[model samples]
Target: MLGRLNHVGIATPSIARSIETYKTLLGADVIGVPFDLPAQGVKVCFIDAPNTQIELIEPYDDASPIAGFLKKNPAGGQHHVCFEVPDIHAAVADMKAKGATILGEPRTGAHGTPIVFVHPRDMGGVLVELMETPQEGAH
Candidate 1:
């Protein structure tokens, strides 16, 4: 089952601008340095939220998955909502048994946690990422 709301993922055309907005306007307390996730095909950063975090993701290149999302909404927008789970494998099995559409096998996420994404259709038109809690950093 899901735990706390882990983060709200926002795909953006410019992560720097997104970081600025969270800092200058929201006054976010913890803004992590952005880093590249070549496997995930995006450059990402985190803006701490009171209860969770805001993950700003940008296309690493035209071939980046986010590139397609940005093409649909040039301004970019909310990409997905992530939730924490105690055990990722169990969660994945449960979701599968329920007939949910899993995107792929659980993999290291931007936060370095084991994470898996379920298709939007199975989640009321919103992509859902289930993350293993107390993320073990990917190195």
Candidate 2:
């Protein structure tokens, strides 16, 4: 099962400006730099929250989901919510068993971690992401 809310993604036009704004507003440390995920057509950066994190995403292509979102809601708002799972593969399997739709198989995400996205139809219209971190001593 997924453990906790990993992070909340916010779509932005400029990740650098968003980082600066978030850092000033939240007084948080920019934990991760914006990295482009060519596979997903988006660039992402992160800032740590109390027990979770804040993720900023920028579209790398006009056809990307964020691009569509920005077109409608130019404010560039919350994109998705992510959950941290102990075992991504098992968690995705469970979600699948529950009739949840997986967007794609697990793959490397920001922070050099493995992750997968769940279709909104299965999650009450809210896009959800499952993230996994290597277990201690799992080498």
Candidate 3:
């Protein structure tokens, strides 16, 4: 059902500070350049880890969903966990059959891959993102 743990998303008030923490404290390498996804309304960056990556997400606007999260947390925290799936449509169906609450329709994510989210309540209060494997020479 799940391929692998793709990335762990960390909600942060500032990506620059998080990058420094990952570099200077965690001794991270291969830090990705931050990019803005206006559609998702967030600025994101990735820090490569041995087994998985750390996604640092910051709200792009006041209307950003992360902004709402930050309002409650103020210091930001673990936003979500993303896992890879071989076939997202099949995965979606499987989840639906099992009575999981799919958050929304499948959409192109930051990686330009088809992805969908499962509701937190159904996943024991952890937001889960299911991402389809990015194929070679494909979007």
Q: Which predicted model would earn the best lDDT?
A: 3
Cα lDDT listed for each candidate: 0.88, 0.83, 0.90
> Ranking under TM-score, best-scoring first?
3, 1, 2
Once model 2 is optimally superposed onto the true structure by TM-score, how far is the C-alpha of residue 18 displaced, in angstroms?
1.4
1 against 2, candidate with superior TM-score: 1
Candidate 3, 83-125: lDDT as tens digits: 9998889999999999999988999887889899999999999
Candidate 1 runs further than 4 Å off = 135-139
lDDT of 2: 0.83
lDDT of 3 at 88: 87
Error of 2 at 125 (Å): 1.8
Model 1 TM-score? Answer: 0.92
Q: Please give, for residues 1-139, the per-residue lDDT of candidate 1 as tens digits.
A: 3488988999999999988888888787698889999998999998877777899999998999889999999998999999988889999999899999899999998877799999999989998999888745432
Selected candidate, larger TM-score, 1 vs 3:
3
Model 3 residue runs over 4 Å out of place are 136-139
lDDT of 2 by residue, 3-120 (tens): 7787899999888888888778878774676688878889888787777788899998887768998888786898899888888899889989999889988998775578999998
